[model samples]
Target: MEASKVIHAIYTDDDVLMSAVKTVKAEKYHIEEIYTPFPVHGLDKAMGLAPTRLAITAFLYGCVGITVATVMMNFIMIQDWPQDIGGKPSFSYLENMPAFVPIMFELTVFFAAHLMVITFYLRSRMWPFKKAENPDPRTTDDHFLMEIAVHNNEESLTNLLKNTGAVEINIVNKDEDAH
Candidate 1:
């Protein structure tokens, strides 16, 4: 298959980049990706991306953590070795739930946080010792890079980006394996 061509429009300021994104979308152009030095508020809305569902996954992870804590505490304290502390020889999980409240809360938080991090890393295709996929290193410091897929309308796209205050514009054939 032929390699796809993309236009990289570099902007110094994020405000200009935001305006340019709106204009590009208004023109019915497909934006491949955008890299910014810092988080740009409402950029996802401008790009028309759906909201992330990580929060739901985190809730599920927290639930699992709670279940595991409850089961483990019941088996270890009530079933395995029932201790008679404070004149209470009750071998019941319900009776000892109050003592396990802190453990349950801590495990829930720990599972949600750690699992969310792992999920994000896997979903983003970021693994240990993986090479960076950034097209320009300047984007990490002070520049914002906007990548737009070219569909044989390079001139018009270039003109539109130039008018939208792009500091530099470059057209290059995108590598299929790079993504």
Candidate 2:
């Protein structure tokens, strides 16, 4: 059986799309998704999406990278192979920390960036070479598509979308993995 019917409301401009989202939200309609050619600032907040925890995870990843760099540097330069800097030997890890600063900083940035990308992909359920959940191809080029589920109020939702300056509105059966 079909999952349910959904409305695909297309807009030509980002501003119009944002306003339409607000209007639909004001009408208490649940927005399944919004597709755009590029990022639309504040759209997630407008859609009432909770703030992401990715930043926190990135910070934690950075700390891990720094910790690994510290341990590796300590073992290599201080414990195993001692080096002389200026007039002091690498017996003290703290004293030799300046030389390892570059490695620590690089590892921190590296972990934060790479791990954040992977986390984002996993959280969003986006995978390379996977079938895209996008309903309209125009959303990839120049249009914005707002998908809203119909809860026995298709007529009201249709009229609401029409009033919100939607250029094209289509009613489509929900795809199995469109969510």
Question: Best-fitting candidate, measured by lDDT?
Answer: 1
Q: Candidate 2, residues 72-177: lDDT per residue as tens digits?
A: 9999989988867677767689987887899999999998899999999998899988887778889999999998988789899999999999999988888654
Write down the TM-score for model 2: 0.93
Off by over 4 Å in 2: 85-88, 176-179
Per-prediction TM-score to the true structure, in the order listed: 0.95, 0.93
For candidate 1, lDDT tens digit of each residue in 1-179?
76899999999998899999999999999999999989999999999999999999999999999999999989998998889888765569998888899999999999999999999999999999999989999999999999999998999999999999999999988985376
Give the clashing pairs for model 2.
none
Write out the backbone clash pairs for model 1. none
Alpha carbon lDDT of each predicted model: 0.94, 0.90
Lowest lDDT block of 10, candidate 1? 82-91
Model 1 regions more than 4 Å off: 176-179
